[model samples]
Target: MKVRFYFITITLACLVLTACNPQTNQIEKTQAPQVIEWEYQIAYQRGMEAVTWSLPAVSMICMRNASFNLGGGYNTVYWLSEIPTAKQEALTANNQTPYANVYLNTKNGPVVLDIPPASNKTALFGSAVDIWQEPIADIGPAGADAGKGGKYVFLPPDYDGSEIEGCINVPSGSYQVFVALRCIPIGGATFKEAAEYAKNINAYSLAEINNPPQGNYIDIAGKHLPTLPDYDFSYFGYIKELMDTEPLQKRDMVMGGMLASIGIEKDKPFIPNDKVKSALTKAIADGYNYLEYMFETPGFSLIKQWEGRQWMNIREPSNDGFVFDEGEYLLMDERGSLFHWATFFPRHLGKATAYLNAMQDADGNLLKGEKQYKLTVPAEVPARDFWSVIVYSKKTKAWIYNDLGRVGLSSYDKENMKLNDDGSVDIFFSETAPEGMESNWIPTNGEDFFLLFRFYGPQESYFDKSFVLPDVQLLK
Candidate 1:
């Protein structure tokens, strides 16, 4: 029978949904409880859990797959010759700097990432993450290489390699890894100069270390790179590929069984029946909604960055790396929430940068592109390099589509920006430039949008909560 056909085979004694009323914060009997098919319910619930557990893995593989589609394979750098725009199509990606990435595979032996030292004040920022999206190590001055630059090696899971040295040896738990780097123009360097310097980044297998292979770099500047995870059946396919390639972890054995219930197994061929596919199809859609709910819910993970403000920190204050290991158990929801909308976190929390999320105005209303909002950046931002505010569609968690090729405003645009007498700049967000504020404005495409304020080289005042960013006020 079809999956919906079983929906009619409902039984009594079970509520259709056990949701509490938001206003009352309590369960009520005002509505009658409905019934659901037992077998379908069991499978659907398991499918939801599978989506949550496998989010990071699926997101990582999405980047790898998209890279391959762009004619770049494993251990080849995909560097950008210019800043990203809407066409880049990565989740919560910024237009602040040029991105450089390398998809690494170490099943055979080990892979090497040779990052060049900072020159002319241009440096790389970001981390080398595994298939799980967990940082194997941070990559810049604030990271393992300490900006001096050196050879970094990624070893396959449990590889019996003899004494590894002279390089940052990152032991991986999976065969798939990716190095995500952003080239920043620091100390009066030009963006064009920084983009050119990113070419020095190289990735090759350990065997090719002596004679590193050349000319595999694919420039993704202003190009369409589809790297965002989707709520489709193919999402599970990515997870399965990861499972098949990665050595099984003791902690994931239970999750492995859950995935099997939905016809996704590591070693076995996947052939889901129509009935099973129907359940999973619905599960992914609902699971995405659940993640959105979690992101907005209070006391979940979005902690207010400034005192009594609506702006929130993207990741909760936790130990660096976002493992969410809380001694007795893991914070699955917390960890999943981070990867759900964003990607590539540093191993050290706020070591090189800080991110603050803005979804609502000074009042508690959600931000809409039809309405205009203005945020007053403090006269002295703690960012040493620059501070940027970018907008993304809240639904897609990606750049808002626009014809102007504009998505953000940063301190780098000060030449055009109109700053107040005190040096504080007022940044505007709306469908069109708010009267005469073109230079300090970002478009939101008349859709439900959110903001991410970034601080490159965050200073002591930022960490100590002294440099507080004010809330965005509605333009009345």
Candidate 2:
């Protein structure tokens, strides 16, 4: 019995040793010792953050050109061409001059106006044809006469002085208007000609301000304006330019940083060399590959659509060439002190308009005999540029009638605007007309119209919400 017990004990000892002792084969299997699951986690987080930081710089550059005088916004509309020609005509009959029409939507309706090269100012053509030209209107909307006290009219491009005063119905919603002259490619027109062209076709239509609907004016005192975040955004433009120049490097840094931030560490060393250099190289390469995979992912290829009216684009990092992305990437740090538009366009119109829907107010009721809604811009309104709350016709997609020959206001025109002691500005919207009020009125013509608030060089006040625009309200 003693001998049998001893044999059993010896067998148990051997088993124990095999389980606890390290083996050469086991160690060899893990040649890349520096790599571990946790290391990957860190790398991922860092890469994502890097991408977030770098994205908005592009938007800032785009925003500089987006201002009130120009009706600049993330998704502000631009007219590409206005060469009036018949569709059935042969190729030779079509005018290829690339004449364009810039448009803005106000409470009155969509304003479809065009500007041609003015023979007077050759020197101001480039800047004038920009969104910022003075004396902006030559001929106002043909639908201005179609006023039914509360109905909007449509105005086609070929709207000759016929009885076809384009007008339509108004839907219930909060709205604002943007007055945009046109877009001339970076070097498309001569500076003087563009400037003079802008001067000629200017102003929001308020021609109906006097006739019927009793009070004659639409109150917009509660209307709000769209604005950008406040930051030292000037530097952001330069950063975007640099990123465009060194695409690959920016990509590498972003990917690498993301991985690092996520706690991904270099765990395993290369074969036979448990050196730090090998491990580090592998770590970076892995991050790059992961980033590449993300770009090609199926979800990244599609564009984000907004409200059936606008189409937002997205950029694929791997796609070469001057390909433009449709969506804007937003970044707000934990404290909300930092706001970033990290996309090619600062405020992409389609997406921005979609976003605007969320904050829109419920407009007041409009009786058939009612004329207009009176509104006032809050004193603390946040924006770097001058602002004008114009009206747009939902049916005809054109601006309403005006006497000031103005559709919107700008910072440069501050002296010309009437302001409250608190710095707030007054604006009017109506289908008929406002008694005694002429210059600061936006005609809505009773149809549904959209509004846009443009900021030129926004300051910190705009982002912090210290300057809040009023909601659109009906005057009793």
Candidate 3:
């Protein structure tokens, strides 16, 4: 009976798909509420999965009673669908925790690989996580050889003493290794949740690395990978259906679509089934109902709360002095802020905005409050492109009011900005415009705001830590 029902439903859905009119077939209100609700939940969940680790061009994070989407930071996210097999093995074999040395057991004891310069800037198993590899036929085990399996592992930083005795096995072929000195910084409860999240995400990332879709690979490192496949798109249709009818499912649908958009899409339509038609016009009407729900309770509810955080344990502090031990919130910053946060939408959802706003500094100043920030681009930032800083509202988690709906200030504004005596540049931010800084002023409207610092054509100064940003503090 259930099978029969599904078949009927799918057939109807297919018919609906065929009849869909690009111009006039939109879902409507006062329609099949039950079916719409169900579709929305399914769409939202799937959409979230597609984008959980995929990078985006811009993303929102609830910070200080406002939405803080890292619009232009300097890192990226490699979705599992986008990784290559060879890199997966490299990432596995090269996995190293803090303070652990690789050893080869000769009868006279173990000899480690020639220790390279701590400044080599090469990961111990760097090549493995290269996001480069040939397609693999079998994903589980490569060959009969245990060593050849090329299985990757991530150990906590504090695995010392007895934990070091056991050797990790790998394929017998000659191999090179790189170590990633990476750690995550997050609150306690959030970290724990993120770790579990990471585990699921890692599975997806590895899957992509092992068997990327052919022709889906984007050009990188002077080569092309056919491994990364476009994200599953049926979910969008599901969201559209849900949004039209189900109120509770509205937030999840939007969240899901936003998340899925973070991964490889190959120009696929961002909106749900632009090609489908609906026989039950009532169902189409449901979409209107869903949009209405988006404006109501928990529709755009920005607060996300955790009993505490969950993340990997910190073995050592990062270059930024933030401890990244085991079981703490771990976020990858290799991709610029915009890309990384965009894919990890779940991290910024729920009570996150409320929590950020809750951080008060005792004198009643907002913790990480809005301030008149002075930004100047020295002649030396790195990248092939330009950069920008934009702000969003905490309560709404959307880009705040913009005269031109611009998200942030960008290098595109360089010619329009005031120049400095030394060839550097300057920009300002504040709740109220300062007396003489109108040209560079970014208005805050007395609300919380996040500043994203970006540098295009970044040079050695960026990689070598010669450039740093002043803290975001409140101004009198």
> By TM-score, who's the top model here?
1
Error of 1 at 334 (Å): 0.8
Q: In model 1, which residue pairs have backbone atoms overlapping below 3 Å?
A: none
Ranking by TM-score, best first?
A: 1, 2, 3
Candidate 3 ranges with C-alpha deviation above 4 Å: 1-341, 344-371, 403-406, 456-458
Estimate the Cα RMSD of every predicted model relative to the unseen true structure. 10.5, 22.9, 21.3
384-473 per-residue lDDT for model 2 (tens digits): 433434343322223333343344444444566666798766776655456766555655545555444444335566444455455555
Worst 10 residues of 1 by lDDT: 11-20
lDDT of 3: 0.30
**Candidate 1 regions with alpha-carbon error over 4 angstroms:** 1-36
Q: Please write out the lDDT profile of model 1 over residues 389-465, one tens digit for every residue.
A: 99999988889888788888888887789999999999988898888888888888898998999998799998898
C-alpha lDDT values of all predictions: 0.82, 0.33, 0.30
Q: What is the lDDT of candidate 2?
A: 0.33
